[model samples]
Every structure is written in structure tokens, then in C-alpha cells.
Target chain A: MEAALPESARGGVAKPSSEADARRRRAFIYGLIAFLLVASLPFLPVNNYIIAAVVRALIFISLGQAWNVVAGIGGLLSLGHGVFLGIGCYTTGILFNQYGIPPWLGVWVGAVLSLLVALVMGSMTLRMRGVFFALATVAASLAMVQISRHFVDLTGGADGLALKFFGNSWWAAQSRTPAPFLYASLAFVTLYYWITRWILNSKLGLEMQAVRDDEVAAAAAGVAVFRTKMLGLLVSAAMTALAAGLYMQFYMAIDPEAAFGLSQAIQLQLPALIGGLGTAWGPIIGGAVMIFLSEVTNWGGTKIGVSGVDILVYGLMLLVVVLYAPKGIVGSVLRNAMKGADR
Target chain B: MNAPAVALEVRNIARNFGGVVALRDVTFSVREGEVVGLIGPNGAGKSTLFEIVSGNIRPSGGRVAYFGRDCTTMASHLRRRAGMCRTFQKVRLFESMTVRQNISVAASQCLPKGRDLGEEVNNILAQMRLEHQAERRPSELTLADRKRVEIGRAIAGHCRLLMLDESLSGLTHDEAEHLIDEIMQLNRARGITVIVVEHVLSVLAAMVQRLVVLHNATVIADGTPSEVAHDPVVIEAYLGTKQKALR
Candidate 1:
């Protein structure tokens, strides 16, 4: 590959050459520094408020990364991902409360159940494109919410189920301080990030992107379009379920409205969209920005004694981002940087 | 000499969209290592027949055989995996990927696990004369280059029989001749059978050994290019009633 490059242009041009090697090395160093800083956060002398905010941000990061697998990389544009999250939350909640199963084991059950549900839903809906596919997912999510609400015996209906606290136990995933929860969420986010990276490098990743770009051309190129889409959906669903299980264990409570609502789905998607969709680092940056904005707005609203001010702020921020950075923050920044480098 | 093996056989193929008939009783067979050209005017069902042969659209009544095995109802991807690949008239390269990445993805389908892809991708880029444009996205390349990328992707697959739909529709004479030479070399050197649908009669006449003309959803002429060109019915189809008077 190196022999293919012209000697004079090898070092200067942004095209394939030693520049790619330099770029990869730079990315690795930056990633390592970021990971170390994040891992050390729990041991730092931070207040409870800071720890809580970090935990919440990490949870959203995991959610956004999971959503990015299907929506960004696979280009599925799902609008009802909360169904899988709800499955995860409810499965863990019920098992821990009813059967006295530890959440460490129950999370796997939730992940499996979510994978099955996603397989069925993706098979039926992956054939549809654009708004029709989005509508089908929304309908599926709404149906799940109704079912959860109607089954008062299994779920507590609208009242929701709550996990009982059995002291600070690692098996129960219960902790007195927010540090352990923060670490757990961070671990999950890291796993999700690596999984996304693996998929991007795999053959399935290439096929999914091909299908996303042009289905007819992809099929003509011998890519099994339906199977690739289903695989993407299954991975996304399972990751989202795992994150939801962690969220429930940390919060110790989950209601159907909170778990399966459109708001939850929007929150899951917003970070990825704001970060830069398919890029590896987009969701992490987007998660931080989202959490910071929400925290600031919430504090401001309370100080002003104004109801729904945070909601208005969120809407305004979304409008600003959409208008200025249509490709999202990370995509815009990286594209401009590359353009400058090319010159 | 034993007869050449059949690469593709289309038997009694017919397709209709509601009350409108697109194709009826379209039957033809392409032999191994042969280069066949399909020619017709717009709406003459040339593309529809290509779709049927490639298994994109199901034929209303027909059996398609690949190397003497029936594959009429096979799915499009399955057909491609079974060594049949095609390119569209409107070039459809993967827009998000680079020129080399497009070919690499297609080649990876035929390659077994753990095979190094760099050499295969480089070979395709060199064959398509797209080495300089390897890192460029499809949108950045010229129309002709984009078309070449699509062809490169098709050839990079496990392609034994290639069906090209108007592959030379928008190219200069020199560019068309270059692609024609490439196709010929591919056929001769690699033993890859080709079925090309082209409207440019001159290029088609120069590239293909056999010509199959479609008129009003039926085969009007099927023979060597010189013979089909001289056929009275084919002349009339192209020149209308004045051709009979001139003759």
C-alpha cells in the first residue's frame, strides 16, 4: 500500500499514506488520555452533585452509543428505541423483585429478551424505509407501553416496580455512594464504545453501511441487506437493554411512563445526533454537552421559579444545533479540520 | 468440438405490469466466455429483461438457468453470490465510501474469512484505472470514473457472468473504446462471460460477438453483429418504413 503513494506527495497530501498512520496514532493517544481521566473521576474529591451528574452523563453516553449502532451506522432511523430499554428495565426489575434474582444475572435475561423482540420487530419493519419505518417503530413502542401498563400483576401498572435495597452489595448492583454507580455506567459506556468500533471494522459493518447508502446497489454487490439490518438491530437492542438495566439498578425504581415514553427515546437519540451520528467519539462529546445543558437549564429554572423552562431551553438548543451544524457537532468539526489539513 | 457450456438460459420469460405487457416469450441463451450485446430503443423492455435475468424482478412465466441449473426464482443477492453480477445504467456506487472501499466491500463478499483485502482492492483499482482516485469518495469522482467504479465493483465480486445495463451510455468515443477493450480483455483473459445492454450501436457492434435486438417486447434479431445489422427486420425497426423503400 505504501508503494502506491507518490514519494513527493506522501507526507503532505491528506490522501492515503503515512498521514493515515499519523492520524491513527494521534487518535489513540487522545483516546487513552480521555479514558484515564474518566476512569479516575470516581477517586477524585468531587461532591455528590458532581458525581450524580457524571453518572447521568455516562448513562446517556451508553444509550447514545447503542442508538448510533442502528441509526447512524446502519441508517435505520428508528424512532422507538425506548421499547428495548423498557424491556431491559422491566425484566431486571421484575426478576429482582419477584424471583429474588440478582441484577447481575437478570441484566443478561433482559438483554436476551430485548434481542428477541428486536429480531421480530426488525424483520417486519426493516423492509420499510424513511417515515414509514419510523412510524412502525413508534407504534411498536406505544403498544409495549400499553401492555406494561395493563399488566398490573407483572408490572405494577402505571405505579411501576421498585427494586428493594439489600444494603451495598455488588451482586445486587446496589450502592450507598454514587461512585460505584458512576463506575458501572462508565464501564458499560466503554464496552458499548468498543462494540461500536468493532462493528465499524467488521464485514457486517461495511455491508450495513452499503445497505444504508443504496439497497439496490448493495444487493447487486452480494450483500444480504435484510440480514445485515437485523444484525444491527439486534446489537443495538441488546446494548440499549443492558444500559436500561443498569439505570434501573442505580435508580431503584422505574415506571412505564419513564421507561417506555417518547421522551426517553428522544433522550436516547439526542446525544448521538448532536455528537455526530456515526463517528466513534461523537456520542461521548454529545453526552457531555447534553448533560451540561440540561443541568444548567434545570438550575436556572429552579432559581427563576419558572415551570417548563428547561423544556423551552432544550427546544431552543436543538433548533440552534440543527440550523448551524446540520451534520452535528463532531461531524462539522472533523470535516473542517480535515479540510484545513488538506490545504 | 464439444459445444460450449451455457452460461445463462432464459426460457419462455414473460413479464406484465397490470394490463401493460413489458415482455413476453423472451428466450435467449448466452454461452460460456461469449460477449453478447442487447440493443433496443427506450421502453423496449431491455432493462426489464436484464432485471429478470439478474433476479431483481420475478418473471411472470419463465425459467432462468445458470450453467444448466434452474435459478428463475432465486433472490438477487443469492444470484450474485452464485457468480452472477450486474451494473446499472445509472451508476450506483456506494456514495459514502471511497473508490477503493467500494471495490473492497464487493470483493470481501467472495473472499473467505481472514484473507488480506489490500492486495485485491489495489488490483481492482489498477484494473479500473482508478488508483489516483482510490481515496476519493464516489461523489467527488467524474461521471465516467463513477461508472468505472461500479464496473470495478461488479468484476471484483465472484463474477462469472456479468450483465451490464447501458454501461457506455454517457462516455466519449475514446472512453467508450477504452472500456470496450477492458471488457474484451476481461472476457478473453479471465473467461468471464458478458451480456452488455448498450444503445450506442457503433460501440456495441465493435465489442460484442453476438447481437440480440428487442422490439415491442420480443426478440427481433439474434445472430452475429454483422448478420443482425444486415437483417431486413432490424433495419426496419431502426429506420421505419422508409428502409423497405430504400432497399
Candidate 2:
């Protein structure tokens, strides 16, 4: 807000003032430049597949960064956060299909519903700890999926809901171009990235991290742990929901299983888990890596004569990364770089 | 001791943990800028009293008033905002963060809004003599340094009343002396009230202006160090006269 820390001190732990302030400012400028570059990539010579893959990666980055707000900073390991995404996607899909609401406005409907779901989920699971909290989130998400399926009249049930871009409105859901969708995803992800960065630098973000590091110590320091966790969950759910709305436009179909599935939940973690949960660029790096791995696995599938080879590759890579670098790739790399700098 | 203002006051407080009575009818007042020592053997309810006064463990009975306001049922954060902060008996720090970051967390998170956190934090670091080790993490510090960081963090808050729970438990004699000097400066120069709970009698005697002796969940003695030091019950509690006489 007040410029930020010094450029040279960017990766180093923040000092009270002086050099760190300059680094913070420089880092912010760098972030803005990076966002602009990524946003302009769809207009470049990249293939449609490459552009689409980048868009998907950006969407994952947004969701991962959102998840970090609650899981990394707030210390709430919500394993079933895909429920918010599912709610968002379905809300937008249903609105666009049944009520002729444009996808642009539908995103808001999805975001609001996700926020409500987060409020209810947070109120129930925010008090639980460790494995209990994780399990509770999974169970709650599972229940939401079941409910969506049971209401087959509104949702297409297991058959899924197809969204046709027939509505009039230049900025609404009528466009068939992947370029706009890519740009849209990039813009949303960039906005989320900056927002999360701002939040991490704010008082609320610090309080959330305090709760994460040590709840008892944070309480002694006067941090309201429950309130911080709730706020983190609300913000996280809203962001995930927005990403889900964008995703519906990209895929053009939504079903309870595809939207709220455990695989989707796992996909949400790939970015953060691989990048470093709380680090600013962790989500982007993790998202890029996952996207690259999927592309590679797809090419390798023809040689290996296997269609679902991507999941196997992902599983093995994650296992290796976790075993060798429990802090994730970006976290380990940053730690090493800092160590080198200190030396 | 500076007679600046009333730092903390407790009126008829009681606490229960399930069926266990942690404290019963505990009432006392702490003066401004005085290092009041609270001492008891293990399971004597000293820690419980500290928790209640610090707003960690809510008292099941009675009110805790600080700086002329009733904070008996106030949330810990509100009390912290009201300039009441404390450190744990065991060291608890942001293990993933470096020492300076841990102290900075207290500054950014606990200090009142718009406070000149940079200057205040720098002053605290200088006072604690922790400037050189700022870049190091909590896990890398020695037992004494880790404890100092924990104390430094509490001191960095907007603190009128500073509560320490066995902060010097594992410190060497030299380290303890250095820390005691800092604690004294916090009171004498800044008018910060201190409630130090410790099992170390000699250090407690040298540091505190007044003494509160607790035993079996109640206040057993309250007075100056010299006066309370010679009390029959105080000596008996500390030395275990029956056991010492038989030996």
C-alpha cells in the first residue's frame, strides 16, 4: 500500500522498514508487469490448444491462490473446496440455460451463492481442527453434490447441463471465440493474484497467518482466530466461485459429478501443493507446472498406448515432489535461493 | 517503584477446568510500573491465574478489571487492543518465520492502528539486544534467545501491562540478568506494568517491587520482597521446612 519493500530485499524476510519498503514496491511493479505480459499472450502466435491450456492454468492459479487464503494463511485445510466451484458453475449454468441470464451476470449469481455456502460451511467447520476439519469439508462437499443430483429438475443431474451461447449482449455469453475466454480467465486470475498479494500484506492477512502458525500464541496476542478463519473462508469461496463461473464458459457444460467431484477438489490443490501454499507466486508456478505436465502426458499417451496416462504421471510427480521436497517446489526453491543470498 | 497508575485489578475471580478448581476467590491489585512476582510450586494455580488475567482462559467466576475497565468477559484481542499482552510459559513462535518476522507480526498484527511500528519495533529490538539475530528463525535460536524473542514479541505490542509466564525458566544466570535489566527498563523508563511468574526465587526477589505468593489456588501472601521473603508461610512453602528439618 505504502509503496512496499525495496527491490533487493524482495525475497528476503521483511525488515521493519528502510530497504524492505523499497523491495516491496519493486516487487509490486514486477507483479503488474508480469500480469500484463500474461494477459497479452492470447494475442500472440500461440496455438489454440496452447492458449486454451494457458487459460485453464490461469483458472487453476486463481483457485489455488484463493485456496491458499484459507488453507495456508488461515490454517484451515478444506479438502472439499470444490463444492464452492461446483455451486458457482451450476448456478451460472442453470441461470444461463433456464432463465436466459447472460454468463456475465451469471458469474455474480454464482459468486453470491458460493459466499453463502462458505458462510454456512465456515460456521460449521471453522471450529474443528486437523483431520476433523479436513474430513468435515469433504463430507459437506459430498453432501452438496448429492443434493444437486437429487434435484434433477433444476440441475441436469448426472446427464449434465449444456450451456448454449445464444443470448444477445456483446459482453454477455454469446461469444464463441476462445480468445475472449482466454483473456477473461487471464484477467480474473491476475486480479485474484494482486488481490491475494494485497491481502497478504494487510493486517487481516497477518492475523490469519498468526492463527495458522500457532493458535494459542495468536490468541495471547489478541488475534480472533475464529473470525479470521471465517473471513478467509468467505473470500476464498468467493474467488473459487468466480473461477468456476469462468470455467463453465470455457467448457460449456456442467454436471454435479464434473463440477463437485473429488477429482476437482484434488485439482484445486495441485497448484498450491506443488508451488508452496502461502507464497505469492506459488499458485502461478504450480498451475504452470501442472498444465505443462498434462500436455506432456497427453503426448506421451500415444507412445505409451494409454489414454488416462496424465493422472498416473501427475500422481507419481506429486509423490516424488512431496517425498523429496515436502515444502513443495517453489517453497524449496525460494528457501534455497534465500540461503544462497544469505551466504 | 513508580506510582504512575493502577495497572491491573482483579475482583473476586474464580476459574474451573471441568471438575478441577483452577482458582477460587483470587483477588489482588497490581500497581503501575511494578514487577509483581507470582510464585507457587507445580499445580498451585499460578499459571491459571495468569491465563485468566491475560484473557486466555476465561474465569468462571468474577471480573478482571484492567486500567479502570472491566475485562473479565472481554475477548483476548480486545484486551490486547486495550494494552494488555503476555508471553507463554513455553516458547511459541512462528516457526516458519524468522525472528524479526515474528516480532514484526506482533507489531503489525497486535499494535494499535497507525502506530509508528517501525520505530517502536526498532526500540524493542535494541532494548532486547536482538538486532544481530533478526534474520534467524525461531528454530535456529538457542533456548534463551527463543525465550527472549517470545518476550520481545509481547513487549512490541501496545502493552501497558506485560505478563510473563516462566519466561526465564531455561535461561542461564547471565542471560536472566540481562533480561531482568531490560524488564526493569520497561517499567522504570516506559511505565509499563509487569507481572512476572517464576519459580526462581532469587531472580524474582531482585526483579519485583511487590510479591504475590500463591498456594493451593489462593493468595497466600502479598507485600514487598523483603517483607514477604521472611514470612513463615513463604519460607515454609519454598524450603519445605518439615522436609528440610528432617534432613
- Using Cα atoms, each model's DockQ against the true complex is 0.40, 0.43
Clashes of each: 0, 15
DockQ of 1: 0.40
Deviation in angstroms for A258 in model 1? 1.6
TM-score of chain A of each: 0.90, 0.88
Off by over 4 Å in 2: A1-46, A127-132, A167-177, A338-343, B1-5, B109-114, B241-247
Query: In model 1, how large is the Cα lDDT of residue A121?
Result: 85
User: In candidate 1, which residue ranges exceed 4 Å CA deviation?
Assistant: A1-16, A128-132, A336-343, B112-116, B239-247
Query: Who wins the lDDT comparison?
Result: 1
